[model samples]
Target: MTEEIIIAGFGGQGVLSMGKILAYSGVMQNKEVSWMPSYGPEMRGGTANVTVILSDERISSPILNSFDTAIILNQQSLDKFEKAVKPGGLLIYDPNGITKLPSRKDINIYSIAAADEAGKLGLSKIFNMIVLGGFLKLKPLVQPEFIHKGLEKSLPARHHKLIPDNEKAIEIGKGLIQAVQVLN
Candidate 1:
Protein backbone atom coordinates (compact mmCIF):
# COMPACT_ATOMS: atom_id res chain seq x y z
CA MET A 1 0.00 0.00 0.00
CA THR A 2 1.13 3.52 -0.75
CA GLU A 3 -0.01 6.55 1.18
CA GLU A 4 0.89 10.06 0.18
CA ILE A 5 0.15 12.57 2.91
CA ILE A 6 0.31 16.29 3.41
CA ILE A 7 0.32 17.81 6.88
CA ALA A 8 0.05 21.57 7.22
CA GLY A 9 -0.22 24.13 10.00
CA PHE A 10 1.41 27.21 11.47
CA GLY A 11 4.97 26.88 12.71
CA GLY A 12 5.41 25.81 16.34
CA GLN A 13 2.29 23.71 15.96
CA GLY A 14 4.39 20.61 15.26
CA VAL A 15 3.34 20.22 11.63
CA LEU A 16 6.79 19.13 10.53
CA SER A 17 7.29 17.04 13.60
CA MET A 18 4.04 15.19 12.95
CA GLY A 19 5.15 14.34 9.45
CA LYS A 20 8.54 13.28 10.76
CA ILE A 21 7.00 10.97 13.31
CA LEU A 22 4.71 9.45 10.72
CA ALA A 23 7.57 8.90 8.35
CA TYR A 24 9.68 7.39 11.06
CA SER A 25 6.86 5.06 11.99
CA GLY A 26 6.57 3.91 8.40
CA VAL A 27 10.27 3.17 8.39
CA MET A 28 9.94 1.19 11.58
CA GLN A 29 7.27 -0.85 9.84
CA ASN A 30 9.66 -1.58 6.98
CA LYS A 31 7.97 0.74 4.55
CA GLU A 32 9.70 3.03 2.11
CA VAL A 33 9.20 6.62 3.25
CA SER A 34 10.07 10.19 2.45
CA TRP A 35 9.52 13.44 4.34
CA MET A 36 9.77 16.97 2.99
CA PRO A 37 9.04 20.13 4.98
CA SER A 38 8.25 23.71 4.01
CA TYR A 39 7.85 26.80 6.15
CA GLY A 40 7.70 30.55 5.98
CA PRO A 41 10.46 32.99 6.92
CA GLU A 42 9.47 33.36 10.54
CA MET A 43 10.19 30.00 12.12
CA ARG A 44 8.03 30.13 15.21
CA GLY A 45 4.73 31.54 14.02
CA GLY A 46 4.96 31.18 10.27
CA THR A 47 3.12 28.77 8.00
CA ALA A 48 4.61 25.28 7.88
CA ASN A 49 3.82 22.11 6.00
CA VAL A 50 5.29 18.71 5.22
CA THR A 51 4.80 16.02 2.64
CA VAL A 52 5.27 12.40 3.61
CA ILE A 53 5.11 9.35 1.38
CA LEU A 54 5.02 5.78 2.59
CA SER A 55 4.80 2.70 0.45
CA ASP A 56 5.49 -0.99 0.46
CA GLU A 57 7.50 -0.69 -2.75
CA ARG A 58 10.32 1.65 -3.68
CA ILE A 59 9.29 5.32 -3.83
CA SER A 60 10.00 7.12 -7.07
CA SER A 61 10.38 10.62 -5.66
CA PRO A 62 9.42 12.83 -2.75
CA ILE A 63 7.60 15.53 -4.78
CA LEU A 64 3.84 15.26 -5.22
CA ASN A 65 1.04 17.44 -6.56
CA SER A 66 -1.71 15.52 -4.87
CA PHE A 67 -2.10 13.31 -1.82
CA ASP A 68 -4.08 10.41 -0.51
CA THR A 69 -4.48 12.15 2.83
CA ALA A 70 -4.41 15.77 3.90
CA ILE A 71 -4.00 16.62 7.58
CA ILE A 72 -4.84 20.29 7.97
CA LEU A 73 -4.29 22.05 11.29
CA ASN A 74 -5.16 25.64 10.36
CA GLN A 75 -7.33 27.68 8.03
CA GLN A 76 -4.51 28.53 5.68
CA SER A 77 -3.59 24.89 5.19
CA LEU A 78 -7.21 23.89 4.77
CA ASP A 79 -7.52 26.49 2.06
CA LYS A 80 -4.31 25.49 0.37
CA PHE A 81 -4.56 21.69 0.41
CA GLU A 82 -8.29 21.14 0.32
CA LYS A 83 -8.32 20.64 -3.41
CA ALA A 84 -5.09 18.77 -3.46
CA VAL A 85 -6.58 15.63 -2.01
CA LYS A 86 -7.25 12.86 -4.49
CA PRO A 87 -10.77 11.77 -5.17
CA GLY A 88 -12.09 9.28 -2.60
CA GLY A 89 -9.15 10.13 -0.38
CA LEU A 90 -9.14 11.42 3.20
CA LEU A 91 -9.10 14.95 4.54
CA ILE A 92 -8.58 15.39 8.26
CA TYR A 93 -8.58 18.75 9.99
CA ASP A 94 -8.60 20.28 13.42
CA PRO A 95 -11.65 22.47 13.96
CA ASN A 96 -9.91 24.93 16.25
CA GLY A 97 -8.29 27.07 13.57
CA ILE A 98 -10.58 26.49 10.62
CA THR A 99 -12.82 29.45 9.79
CA LYS A 100 -14.39 27.79 6.76
CA LEU A 101 -15.36 24.15 6.88
CA PRO A 102 -14.33 21.93 4.01
CA SER A 103 -16.86 21.37 1.26
CA ARG A 104 -16.06 18.24 -0.69
CA LYS A 105 -18.06 15.17 -1.48
CA ASP A 106 -15.53 13.15 -3.36
CA ILE A 107 -13.31 12.63 -0.35
CA ASN A 108 -13.85 11.51 3.22
CA ILE A 109 -13.71 14.38 5.72
CA TYR A 110 -13.02 14.17 9.44
CA SER A 111 -12.52 16.71 12.19
CA ILE A 112 -10.25 16.18 15.17
CA ALA A 113 -10.53 18.85 17.85
CA ALA A 114 -6.88 18.45 18.68
CA ALA A 115 -6.26 21.87 20.17
CA ASP A 116 -9.30 21.82 22.41
CA GLU A 117 -8.60 18.28 23.53
CA ALA A 118 -4.96 18.99 24.17
CA GLY A 119 -5.90 21.98 26.28
CA LYS A 120 -8.26 19.79 28.26
CA LEU A 121 -5.41 17.35 28.87
CA GLY A 122 -3.05 20.16 29.81
CA LEU A 123 -0.60 19.11 27.13
CA SER A 124 0.75 21.82 24.89
CA LYS A 125 3.40 19.81 23.07
CA ILE A 126 1.66 16.54 22.30
CA PHE A 127 -1.02 18.17 20.21
CA ASN A 128 0.37 16.79 16.98
CA MET A 129 0.54 13.26 18.34
CA ILE A 130 -3.15 13.53 19.18
CA VAL A 131 -3.94 14.52 15.65
CA LEU A 132 -1.77 11.72 14.40
CA GLY A 133 -3.76 9.32 16.51
CA GLY A 134 -7.00 10.56 15.00
CA PHE A 135 -5.61 10.03 11.57
CA LEU A 136 -4.46 6.54 12.45
CA LYS A 137 -7.88 5.74 13.79
CA LEU A 138 -9.38 6.63 10.42
CA LYS A 139 -6.66 5.11 8.25
CA PRO A 140 -4.67 2.67 10.37
CA LEU A 141 -1.80 3.12 7.96
CA VAL A 142 0.76 2.16 10.56
CA GLN A 143 0.51 0.04 13.66
CA PRO A 144 0.22 1.66 17.10
CA GLU A 145 3.33 -0.15 18.27
CA PHE A 146 5.27 1.45 15.44
CA ILE A 147 3.94 4.82 16.49
CA HIS A 148 5.24 4.28 20.03
CA LYS A 149 8.57 3.21 18.64
CA GLY A 150 8.55 6.18 16.30
CA LEU A 151 8.00 8.49 19.24
CA GLU A 152 10.99 6.98 20.97
CA LYS A 153 13.09 7.34 17.84
CA SER A 154 11.99 10.84 16.92
CA LEU A 155 12.27 12.41 20.36
CA PRO A 156 15.59 13.23 21.93
CA ALA A 157 16.69 11.19 24.93
CA ARG A 158 16.01 14.03 27.33
CA HIS A 159 12.39 14.18 26.18
CA HIS A 160 11.77 10.43 26.34
CA LYS A 161 10.13 10.73 29.73
CA LEU A 162 7.13 12.35 28.04
CA ILE A 163 6.36 9.33 25.85
CA PRO A 164 3.56 8.12 28.07
CA ASP A 165 1.92 11.53 27.97
CA ASN A 166 2.21 11.58 24.21
CA GLU A 167 0.67 8.12 24.03
CA LYS A 168 -2.24 9.36 26.10
CA ALA A 169 -2.66 12.31 23.78
CA ILE A 170 -2.84 9.95 20.81
CA GLU A 171 -5.58 7.95 22.47
CA ILE A 172 -7.48 11.14 23.21
CA GLY A 173 -7.24 12.15 19.58
CA LYS A 174 -8.46 8.78 18.41
CA GLY A 175 -11.61 9.23 20.44
CA LEU A 176 -12.19 12.84 19.46
CA ILE A 177 -12.21 12.59 15.66
CA GLN A 178 -15.66 12.65 14.12
CA ALA A 179 -16.79 12.21 10.56
CA VAL A 180 -18.36 15.30 9.04
CA GLN A 181 -21.11 15.48 6.47
CA VAL A 182 -19.76 15.36 2.95
CA LEU A 183 -20.89 18.14 0.64
CA ASN A 184 -22.44 17.26 -2.65
Candidate 2:
Protein backbone atom coordinates (compact mmCIF):
# COMPACT_ATOMS: atom_id res chain seq x y z
CA MET A 1 0.00 0.00 0.00
CA THR A 2 1.12 3.53 -0.76
CA GLU A 3 0.03 6.61 1.14
CA GLU A 4 1.04 10.04 -0.03
CA ILE A 5 0.55 12.58 2.70
CA ILE A 6 0.88 16.29 3.25
CA ILE A 7 1.28 17.78 6.70
CA ALA A 8 1.03 21.57 6.77
CA GLY A 9 1.02 24.28 9.41
CA PHE A 10 2.83 27.37 10.59
CA GLY A 11 6.45 27.07 11.48
CA GLY A 12 7.29 26.07 15.06
CA GLN A 13 4.14 23.96 15.07
CA GLY A 14 6.14 20.78 14.34
CA VAL A 15 4.76 20.28 10.86
CA LEU A 16 8.10 19.18 9.49
CA SER A 17 8.87 17.10 12.52
CA MET A 18 5.58 15.28 12.19
CA GLY A 19 6.40 14.35 8.61
CA LYS A 20 9.87 13.23 9.66
CA ILE A 21 8.53 11.02 12.40
CA LEU A 22 6.03 9.47 10.01
CA ALA A 23 8.71 8.83 7.40
CA TYR A 24 10.93 7.22 10.00
CA SER A 25 8.06 5.07 11.17
CA GLY A 26 7.54 3.80 7.66
CA VAL A 27 11.24 2.99 7.45
CA MET A 28 11.09 1.12 10.73
CA GLN A 29 8.28 -0.95 9.27
CA ASN A 30 10.43 -1.84 6.24
CA LYS A 31 8.48 0.45 3.98
CA GLU A 32 9.87 2.82 1.38
CA VAL A 33 9.56 6.39 2.60
CA SER A 34 10.31 9.92 1.45
CA TRP A 35 10.05 13.27 3.25
CA MET A 36 10.29 16.76 1.76
CA PRO A 37 9.78 20.01 3.71
CA SER A 38 8.99 23.54 2.68
CA TYR A 39 9.12 26.69 4.75
CA GLY A 40 9.10 30.43 4.18
CA PRO A 41 11.77 32.96 5.14
CA GLU A 42 10.01 33.94 8.37
CA MET A 43 10.58 30.45 9.75
CA ARG A 44 9.26 30.49 13.31
CA GLY A 45 6.07 32.32 12.37
CA GLY A 46 6.03 31.47 8.71
CA THR A 47 4.20 28.80 6.79
CA ALA A 48 5.65 25.33 6.75
CA ASN A 49 4.64 22.10 5.10
CA VAL A 50 6.01 18.67 4.35
CA THR A 51 5.23 15.92 1.92
CA VAL A 52 5.69 12.33 2.99
CA ILE A 53 5.18 9.15 1.07
CA LEU A 54 5.18 5.66 2.55
CA SER A 55 4.87 2.65 0.36
CA ASP A 56 5.45 -1.07 0.44
CA GLU A 57 7.08 -0.89 -2.99
CA ARG A 58 9.76 1.33 -4.44
CA ILE A 59 8.79 5.00 -4.65
CA SER A 60 9.26 6.70 -7.99
CA SER A 61 9.37 10.32 -6.86
CA PRO A 62 9.02 12.55 -3.85
CA ILE A 63 7.11 15.31 -5.65
CA LEU A 64 3.34 15.14 -5.77
CA ASN A 65 0.49 17.37 -6.86
CA SER A 66 -2.18 15.51 -4.92
CA PHE A 67 -2.16 13.42 -1.80
CA ASP A 68 -4.02 10.49 -0.30
CA THR A 69 -4.07 12.27 3.02
CA ALA A 70 -3.79 15.91 4.05
CA ILE A 71 -3.06 16.79 7.67
CA ILE A 72 -3.78 20.51 8.04
CA LEU A 73 -2.94 22.26 11.29
CA ASN A 74 -3.93 25.77 10.31
CA GLN A 75 -6.42 27.55 8.10
CA GLN A 76 -3.77 28.66 5.65
CA SER A 77 -2.83 25.07 5.01
CA LEU A 78 -6.46 24.11 4.69
CA ASP A 79 -6.93 26.82 2.08
CA LYS A 80 -3.83 25.74 0.24
CA PHE A 81 -4.14 21.97 0.28
CA GLU A 82 -7.86 21.39 0.56
CA LYS A 83 -8.26 20.86 -3.13
CA ALA A 84 -5.07 18.91 -3.40
CA VAL A 85 -6.50 15.84 -1.77
CA LYS A 86 -7.38 13.03 -4.14
CA PRO A 87 -10.98 12.03 -4.49
CA GLY A 88 -12.15 9.61 -1.80
CA GLY A 89 -9.02 10.45 0.21
CA LEU A 90 -8.71 11.70 3.76
CA LEU A 91 -8.47 15.27 5.02
CA ILE A 92 -7.62 15.72 8.68
CA TYR A 93 -7.40 19.11 10.33
CA ASP A 94 -7.13 20.70 13.73
CA PRO A 95 -10.12 23.00 14.17
CA ASN A 96 -8.28 25.35 16.50
CA GLY A 97 -6.81 27.49 13.74
CA ILE A 98 -9.35 26.98 11.03
CA THR A 99 -11.69 29.86 10.42
CA LYS A 100 -13.52 28.15 7.61
CA LEU A 101 -14.51 24.56 7.80
CA PRO A 102 -13.70 22.35 4.86
CA SER A 103 -16.53 21.69 2.40
CA ARG A 104 -15.88 18.66 0.32
CA LYS A 105 -18.11 15.83 -0.69
CA ASP A 106 -15.60 13.40 -2.10
CA ILE A 107 -13.29 12.97 0.86
CA ASN A 108 -13.52 11.90 4.47
CA ILE A 109 -12.88 14.88 6.74
CA TYR A 110 -11.84 14.60 10.38
CA SER A 111 -11.09 17.16 13.04
CA ILE A 112 -8.51 16.53 15.71
CA ALA A 113 -8.63 19.23 18.33
CA ALA A 114 -4.93 18.85 18.94
CA ALA A 115 -4.24 22.30 20.30
CA ASP A 116 -7.14 22.25 22.73
CA GLU A 117 -6.38 18.74 23.94
CA ALA A 118 -2.68 19.44 24.21
CA GLY A 119 -3.39 22.49 26.30
CA LYS A 120 -5.71 20.50 28.54
CA LEU A 121 -3.12 17.76 28.92
CA GLY A 122 -0.28 20.26 29.37
CA LEU A 123 1.51 18.83 26.37
CA SER A 124 2.30 21.78 24.13
CA LYS A 125 5.44 20.55 22.44
CA ILE A 126 4.09 17.18 21.41
CA PHE A 127 0.99 18.53 19.73
CA ASN A 128 2.03 17.15 16.39
CA MET A 129 2.34 13.64 17.78
CA ILE A 130 -1.19 13.88 19.04
CA VAL A 131 -2.39 14.81 15.59
CA LEU A 132 -0.32 12.00 14.16
CA GLY A 133 -2.07 9.66 16.54
CA GLY A 134 -5.43 10.89 15.32
CA PHE A 135 -4.39 10.28 11.74
CA LEU A 136 -3.17 6.80 12.56
CA LYS A 137 -6.48 5.97 14.21
CA LEU A 138 -8.23 6.47 10.89
CA LYS A 139 -5.53 5.33 8.51
CA PRO A 140 -3.44 2.82 10.49
CA LEU A 141 -0.98 2.74 7.65
CA VAL A 142 1.94 2.33 10.09
CA GLN A 143 1.97 0.52 13.38
CA PRO A 144 2.13 2.33 16.70
CA GLU A 145 5.22 0.33 17.73
CA PHE A 146 6.95 1.55 14.60
CA ILE A 147 5.93 5.11 15.52
CA HIS A 148 7.50 4.71 18.95
CA LYS A 149 10.69 3.44 17.39
CA GLY A 150 10.51 6.25 14.89
CA LEU A 151 10.23 8.78 17.71
CA GLU A 152 13.42 7.35 19.14
CA LYS A 153 15.15 7.66 15.80
CA SER A 154 13.84 11.19 15.11
CA LEU A 155 14.43 12.81 18.51
CA PRO A 156 17.83 13.73 19.88
CA ALA A 157 19.07 11.78 22.89
CA ARG A 158 18.74 14.76 25.18
CA HIS A 159 15.06 15.04 24.40
CA HIS A 160 14.37 11.33 24.81
CA LYS A 161 13.14 11.93 28.34
CA LEU A 162 9.92 13.29 26.87
CA ILE A 163 9.08 10.19 24.86
CA PRO A 164 6.65 8.88 27.41
CA ASP A 165 4.78 12.16 27.45
CA ASN A 166 4.69 12.22 23.71
CA GLU A 167 3.27 8.71 23.72
CA LYS A 168 0.55 9.88 26.03
CA ALA A 169 -0.14 12.81 23.76
CA ILE A 170 -0.57 10.42 20.85
CA GLU A 171 -3.10 8.41 22.79
CA ILE A 172 -4.94 11.56 23.71
CA GLY A 173 -5.04 12.55 20.05
CA LYS A 174 -6.38 9.15 19.06
CA GLY A 175 -9.32 9.66 21.37
CA LEU A 176 -9.87 13.32 20.51
CA ILE A 177 -10.41 13.06 16.78
CA GLN A 178 -14.01 13.34 15.58
CA ALA A 179 -15.42 12.64 12.20
CA VAL A 180 -16.46 16.00 10.84
CA GLN A 181 -17.57 14.80 7.45
CA VAL A 182 -17.78 11.42 5.76
CA LEU A 183 -18.36 10.58 2.15
CA ASN A 184 -21.23 8.27 1.48
Candidate 3:
Protein backbone atom coordinates (compact mmCIF):
# COMPACT_ATOMS: atom_id res chain seq x y z
CA MET A 1 0.00 0.00 0.00
CA THR A 2 1.20 3.49 -0.78
CA GLU A 3 0.38 6.34 1.57
CA GLU A 4 1.43 9.92 1.02
CA ILE A 5 1.12 12.29 3.94
CA ILE A 6 1.75 15.99 4.07
CA ILE A 7 2.67 17.78 7.26
CA ALA A 8 2.44 21.56 7.09
CA GLY A 9 2.81 24.40 9.53
CA PHE A 10 4.60 27.67 10.15
CA GLY A 11 8.35 27.59 10.39
CA GLY A 12 9.76 26.22 13.66
CA GLN A 13 6.59 24.25 14.34
CA GLY A 14 8.51 21.00 13.76
CA VAL A 15 6.85 20.08 10.46
CA LEU A 16 10.08 18.68 9.04
CA SER A 17 10.82 16.84 12.23
CA MET A 18 7.42 15.19 12.09
CA GLY A 19 8.13 13.95 8.58
CA LYS A 20 11.49 12.61 9.70
CA ILE A 21 9.88 10.66 12.48
CA LEU A 22 7.37 9.11 10.08
CA ALA A 23 10.03 8.22 7.51
CA TYR A 24 12.21 6.70 10.19
CA SER A 25 9.30 4.70 11.51
CA GLY A 26 8.56 3.39 8.03
CA VAL A 27 12.17 2.28 7.82
CA MET A 28 11.84 0.46 11.11
CA GLN A 29 8.69 -1.22 9.85
CA ASN A 30 10.48 -2.45 6.72
CA LYS A 31 8.66 -0.16 4.33
CA GLU A 32 9.91 2.11 1.59
CA VAL A 33 9.88 5.73 2.75
CA SER A 34 10.81 9.19 1.56
CA TRP A 35 10.42 12.64 3.08
CA MET A 36 10.65 15.84 1.04
CA PRO A 37 10.37 19.23 2.70
CA SER A 38 9.73 22.64 1.16
CA TYR A 39 10.52 25.96 2.85
CA GLY A 40 10.66 28.35 -0.09
CA PRO A 41 10.25 32.02 0.96
CA GLU A 42 8.33 30.94 4.05
CA MET A 43 11.29 29.81 6.10
CA ARG A 44 11.32 32.99 8.16
CA GLY A 45 7.70 32.93 9.35
CA GLY A 46 5.80 31.69 6.37
CA THR A 47 4.53 28.24 5.56
CA ALA A 48 6.55 25.03 5.61
CA ASN A 49 5.45 21.65 4.34
CA VAL A 50 6.83 18.13 4.15
CA THR A 51 5.63 15.21 2.10
CA VAL A 52 6.22 11.74 3.50
CA ILE A 53 5.65 8.64 1.40
CA LEU A 54 5.37 5.11 2.74
CA SER A 55 4.90 2.00 0.66
CA ASP A 56 5.16 -1.73 0.98
CA GLU A 57 7.27 -2.04 -2.15
CA ARG A 58 10.03 0.03 -3.70
CA ILE A 59 9.09 3.68 -4.13
CA SER A 60 9.53 5.12 -7.61
CA SER A 61 9.17 8.80 -6.69
CA PRO A 62 9.50 10.70 -3.45
CA ILE A 63 7.59 13.69 -4.76
CA LEU A 64 3.83 13.57 -4.43
CA ASN A 65 1.49 15.32 -6.85
CA SER A 66 -1.39 14.70 -4.47
CA PHE A 67 -1.33 13.56 -0.90
CA ASP A 68 -3.59 11.00 0.75
CA THR A 69 -3.31 12.68 4.13
CA ALA A 70 -2.36 16.08 5.52
CA ILE A 71 -1.59 17.34 9.03
CA ILE A 72 -2.03 21.10 9.23
CA LEU A 73 -0.65 22.85 12.29
CA ASN A 74 -1.81 26.38 11.51
CA GLN A 75 -4.64 28.17 9.76
CA GLN A 76 -2.39 29.31 6.92
CA SER A 77 -1.24 25.76 6.42
CA LEU A 78 -4.82 24.54 6.53
CA ASP A 79 -5.78 27.10 3.89
CA LYS A 80 -2.83 26.17 1.73
CA PHE A 81 -3.28 22.39 1.82
CA GLU A 82 -7.00 21.94 2.40
CA LYS A 83 -7.64 21.88 -1.32
CA ALA A 84 -4.70 19.66 -2.21
CA VAL A 85 -5.59 16.51 -0.33
CA LYS A 86 -6.74 13.64 -2.47
CA PRO A 87 -10.40 12.71 -2.52
CA GLY A 88 -11.32 10.33 0.33
CA GLY A 89 -8.12 11.36 2.07
CA LEU A 90 -7.64 12.35 5.70
CA LEU A 91 -6.79 15.81 6.99
CA ILE A 92 -5.72 16.29 10.58
CA TYR A 93 -5.61 19.84 11.89
CA ASP A 94 -4.74 21.60 15.10
CA PRO A 95 -7.96 23.43 15.85
CA ASN A 96 -6.23 25.67 18.36
CA GLY A 97 -4.06 27.16 15.63
CA ILE A 98 -6.39 26.68 12.67
CA THR A 99 -9.76 28.32 13.29
CA LYS A 100 -11.25 27.65 9.88
CA LEU A 101 -11.54 24.70 7.53
CA PRO A 102 -12.44 24.19 3.94
CA SER A 103 -15.95 23.02 3.10
CA ARG A 104 -14.78 19.86 1.47
CA LYS A 105 -17.05 16.84 1.72
CA ASP A 106 -14.77 14.37 -0.02
CA ILE A 107 -11.97 14.54 2.48
CA ASN A 108 -12.28 13.47 6.11
CA ILE A 109 -11.09 16.09 8.59
CA TYR A 110 -9.93 15.38 12.12
CA SER A 111 -9.50 18.44 14.28
CA ILE A 112 -7.42 18.26 17.44
CA ALA A 113 -6.26 20.93 19.80
CA ALA A 114 -2.64 19.79 19.65
CA ALA A 115 -0.90 23.01 20.66
CA ASP A 116 -3.26 23.52 23.56
CA GLU A 117 -2.81 19.93 24.65
CA ALA A 118 0.93 20.28 24.37
CA GLY A 119 0.84 23.38 26.52
CA LYS A 120 -1.25 21.57 29.09
CA LEU A 121 1.16 18.67 29.05
CA GLY A 122 4.16 20.99 29.49
CA LEU A 123 5.62 19.86 26.17
CA SER A 124 4.69 22.71 23.88
CA LYS A 125 7.82 22.34 21.80
CA ILE A 126 7.05 18.71 21.03
CA PHE A 127 3.66 19.32 19.53
CA ASN A 128 4.84 17.54 16.44
CA MET A 129 4.97 14.35 18.46
CA ILE A 130 1.36 14.94 19.37
CA VAL A 131 0.44 15.30 15.71
CA LEU A 132 2.36 12.16 14.91
CA GLY A 133 0.28 10.42 17.51
CA GLY A 134 -2.88 11.42 15.72
CA PHE A 135 -1.43 10.27 12.42
CA LEU A 136 -0.48 6.92 13.85
CA LYS A 137 -3.95 6.37 15.23
CA LEU A 138 -5.79 7.49 12.12
CA LYS A 139 -3.56 5.88 9.51
CA PRO A 140 -2.45 2.31 9.93
CA LEU A 141 0.53 2.75 7.65
CA VAL A 142 2.85 1.74 10.49
CA GLN A 143 2.37 0.14 13.86
CA PRO A 144 2.45 2.11 17.12
CA GLU A 145 5.34 0.01 18.42
CA PHE A 146 7.35 0.89 15.35
CA ILE A 147 6.71 4.58 15.99
CA HIS A 148 7.78 4.29 19.62
CA LYS A 149 10.93 2.51 18.60
CA GLY A 150 11.61 5.11 15.96
CA LEU A 151 11.26 7.83 18.53
CA GLU A 152 13.84 6.11 20.66
CA LYS A 153 16.27 6.14 17.76
CA SER A 154 15.33 9.55 16.38
CA LEU A 155 16.60 11.54 19.34
CA PRO A 156 20.28 11.90 20.15
CA ALA A 157 21.82 9.80 22.89
CA ARG A 158 22.16 12.79 25.18
CA HIS A 159 18.44 13.35 24.90
CA HIS A 160 17.48 9.85 25.91
CA LYS A 161 15.83 11.39 28.91
CA LEU A 162 13.26 13.03 26.68
CA ILE A 163 12.06 9.82 25.13
CA PRO A 164 9.66 9.03 27.93
CA ASP A 165 8.00 12.40 27.65
CA ASN A 166 7.80 12.11 23.89
CA GLU A 167 6.26 8.69 24.22
CA LYS A 168 3.77 10.09 26.69
CA ALA A 169 2.85 12.82 24.25
CA ILE A 170 2.29 10.25 21.54
CA GLU A 171 0.03 8.19 23.78
CA ILE A 172 -1.92 11.23 24.86
CA GLY A 173 -2.40 12.32 21.29
CA LYS A 174 -3.58 8.92 20.24
CA GLY A 175 -5.96 8.66 23.15
CA LEU A 176 -7.45 12.08 22.52
CA ILE A 177 -7.98 11.46 18.83
CA GLN A 178 -9.33 8.00 19.47
CA ALA A 179 -11.82 9.46 21.93
CA VAL A 180 -13.01 11.86 19.30
CA GLN A 181 -13.62 9.02 16.92
CA VAL A 182 -15.49 7.08 19.57
CA LEU A 183 -17.67 10.04 20.33
CA ASN A 184 -18.54 10.37 16.68
State the C-alpha lDDT per candidate: 0.91, 0.91, 0.82
- 78-181, model 1: which lDDT tens digit per residue? 99999999999999999996789999899999999899888887897889999999998998988989988998999999999998998888888889999999
Q: In model 2, what are the clashing residue pairs, if there are any?
A: none
RMSD of each: 1.3, 1.8, 2.8
Runs off by more than 4 Å, candidate 3 = 178-184
On a 0 to 100 scale, what is the lDDT of residue 38 in model 3? 90
lDDT of 2 by residue, 79-121 (tens): 9999999999999999996888899988899999999888887
Give the range of the ten consecutive residues with the poorest summed lDDT in model 3: 175-184
Model 3: per-residue lDDT, tens digit, 1-184?
9998889888999999888888998899999998888957877778888989999888887787788998888888878888889998888888775555556777787877788889887899888888888888887677878887777777788987888888778777887663223121
Clash count list over all predictions = 0, 0, 0
Quality of model 2 by C-alpha lDDT: 0.91
TM-scores of the candidates are: 0.96, 0.95, 0.91
